[model samples]
Target: MELLPFDEYVRSLDRKRMSAGVLFRDAEGRVLLVEPSYKAQWEIPGGSVDAGESPWAAASREVREELGIERVFTRLLVIDYVPDDGRMPEGIAFVFDGGLITNAEVAALELTDPEIVSAGLFFLDAVPSLKATLAARLAIALRAAQAGEPLLSENGTELT
Candidate 1:
């Protein structure tokens, strides 16, 4: 993974920024997660899309940037929005799923934005530590991935 100056690159663009994330899983089906140097919580790898980039393209681009090696066979999972809290601008997020190869050189990236960064593989049982929205997103994505129930309402009943 190459460490281009993220903030420096961000400032260089005259483009609207968007982002996409991929939930990477190993051959054994364990999830690959990053302990972000910036974020206090763990997150899947992804980041902003430059001008003229599609979300799929951005997902691949961001994953390569953040993870150092590009192996994302990405599929779009969802689109989400976080509104501004009067302090920060809103964010548009695209979430996807990918398969990770364990042999990839994951050690090359600095993971520097937050500090004390590390990566890990965890079983599904460890998902509870994730932030609620992320947990929901991951759950929904995985369910879709597994061909979840269709035509069902939020409750137990089927939609008319």
Candidate 2:
């Protein structure tokens, strides 16, 4: 891979933190994974929140832009922060529970960014290895859904 200019690389390395939205299983418990051509991981569908955008709005917008499906509803699942960075600028991953639907209504799955190689749905029991934090979040979301609680786990832990 080509390297970035020294100043630009330094600026990125120095930027301490940001927030990301995570969209996992749709309402029915089917897992959704996106492989954006630009990103190496088959990430949960969400992105950085723009300045002034609420987490809920950010989630919906990202789903629309990245997945092309309307995220009809979304709410806070949890606020996750990695603490080693002093938390001043830690990635506050906001997990969002989005509606259950497929893109077949308008067309086959489309990637807002061409770099997205493809999208797939997998059975929960068959989910592949996922990034650690994201896998935890998915387990949380699925547990919430199976129990009919949107924002709380059966163990009395709030999903958020």
- How high is each candidate's TM-score? 0.62, 0.66
Instruction: Candidate 1: list runs displaced more than 4 Å.
Output: 1-17, 27-29, 71-74, 85-87, 100-116, 124-129, 148-160
Model 1: residue 118 alpha-carbon error in angstroms:
1.8
Tally clashes: model 2.
4
Model 2 Cα shift for residue 7 (angstroms): 30
What's model 1's overall lDDT? 0.61
Error of 2 at 156 (Å): 16
Model 1 Cα lDDT, one tens digit per residue, 1-160:
7766989888886533467778776676666677766767777777777778777788787666666555654466556665564765666667776755463544455554443367666665685356656655555555555563222222111123
Best by TM-score: 2
Worst 10 residues of 1 by lDDT: 150-159
TM-score of 1: 0.62
What Cα-based lDDT does every candidate model obtain?
0.61, 0.62
Local error of candidate 1 at residue 88 (angstroms): 3.9
Error of 2 at 118 (Å): 1.0
